[model samples]
Target: MTTAYISRPASAPLVGIGWMVAAGLCFVGMTVLIKSVGAALPAAQTAVLRFALGLPFLLPMLPALARVRLTPSHWKLLSLRAVLHSAGVGLWFFAIARIPLGEVTAINYLNPIWVTVGAALLMGERLPPRRLAAVAAAFIGALVVLRPGLREIDPGHVAMMGTAMLIASGYLVVKRLSEDLPAEVIVAMMSLMVPLGLLPFALPVWQTPGATELILLFAAAGLGTAGHYTMTRAFAAAPLTVTQPVTFLQLVWAVAVGALLFGEPVDPFTLLGGAIIMGAVIFITWREARARRAAIAAAPDALLSRSASGPAARGSSRG
Candidate 1:
């Protein structure tokens, strides 16, 4: 089954670029907020608060959810995704607390690479030679960033890697469910579910946040939700390949934010590694788009051949 994406208005690529830039800003802002509050609360508690507080913004979509007919299988997949997402967010919060914001953000770029591999393994999609090379290059880039043997590997690094993998798995489920469900419904369900899933873990370490922390958390949630919405709009407006490259700006913003706000020195190795990873991801995205277009272009010919053979096969059977 193919997903029917909502039709978007024909907008200029510039408009998509603008939305993408806004999304980068929002994402960076959210990360900054998370880092700022990391010292005050436990990761799981922060994750719970984020989703719980953000639940109100998602309420408007509840009416839309009523329109979606969800099966038992759909509910199961959604529940699994919720659990994975909650875990990913919890890990991310922990990583942010222990690591530089820039490093955490840079490492998170591994999500797309993980998604590509997940597609191959879970969806049985063929991994072409070019994508295989891209995957290798991405890992090499990761090595450059981490320099694992040179420095003692931190728990934060492990957490971020696990976060990427789990999140990627959740995305795979999202892709499958998207074939039948509206994006709004999928997002809303995840938003509602994450808080519930994280509540238990959060309870043990929960502390009442001060007014400033509360305000910051709320703002971060808003930015995160807005970022996702804008990203969706951008994808709808323009091709994924077109907007994909713009995302690298987030890493730049991350570096700047870390340096200015946290007084973390900019690491050249991390920047180089992030650039390499981004390059590979961009190439993979472009290659996939090309392949998809080729498939679509050949589809009509395949259908025409089948149609032409139909009458002959029927006559042979009759004879």
Candidate 2:
């Protein structure tokens, strides 16, 4: 089967950038809410509530969900992905509650590195030399940020790293599913599945949240949902290379928010490490885009050659 990778129109890059910026802002807002409300809520409970709150927004997609065709294999994959995602979110909530918001966000940038490794090992995708170098550089940057020997490593840091690994695994599953399923169907299933996965974990530690905490959690749910939707739209509008760089803005926003709102001082090490990581990710994305473009450019010649051979072979056979 032929695979078509759509290239956006020239004008769409700007629109994608706008959506990415909005997504960054929404993500920062959600992080802030998580940090605030997490003080009074259990991590698992908060995760469950966040997904529960977001479910209403997805209710309209039920008809679309019903139309999706799924096999037992698909359901198994979906369940695995959901479990990974729920665990990741729970760990993230726990990490944010204990660590500085800026540090947590910086650590989360490790996701791309995890994605690179996962794709190579799990998907059997070849990692070009440049991407391999990029991954190495990103890991060095993470080490700089953590400075394991120089500073005391907190459990929160470990949790964030685990979060990155699990989330990256879930993303790989999404990539596989996207080959056969609509993006909406994948998202809708996730919306339903994560909560169900978290319900048992949440029930054990559930405490009645006050009015303010409830509102904050709901607000977080809204921001997180909006961010994901906008980010997806941005990717659809433009190539990954074009939109991925825009996400670096989230680190800046996270640092600023942490400093201003929570009085968490800016750490130069974190900023430098984050910049390095993002730079590597951007380079990797650019290389991938170039490779795809080359492939797309050559496809027409390939098709023409095949067509030319077909007619000549038929004539020879007839003669």
Candidate 1 residue runs with Cα over 4 Å from true position? 1-11, 307-319
Clashing pairs in 2: none
| Tens-place lDDT digits, model 2, residues 1-319 | 5666677466499899999999999999999998999669899998888888888888778888999889998998899999999999999999999888877888898887898899999889999788999999998888888899999999999999899999999999999988888877898999899989989998988899888888998999899989988998898788888899898889988989999999888898988888888988898889888999899889988997898899999999999
Candidate 1 local lDDT, 151-194, one digit each (tens): 88889989998998999999999999999898889999998899
Winning model by lDDT: 1
Worst ten in a row by lDDT for model 1: 1-10
User: How does candidate 1 score on lDDT?
Assistant: 0.90
Deviation in Å, model 2, residue 247 alpha carbon:
0.9
Q: Go through the candidates in order and give the clash count of each.
A: 0, 0
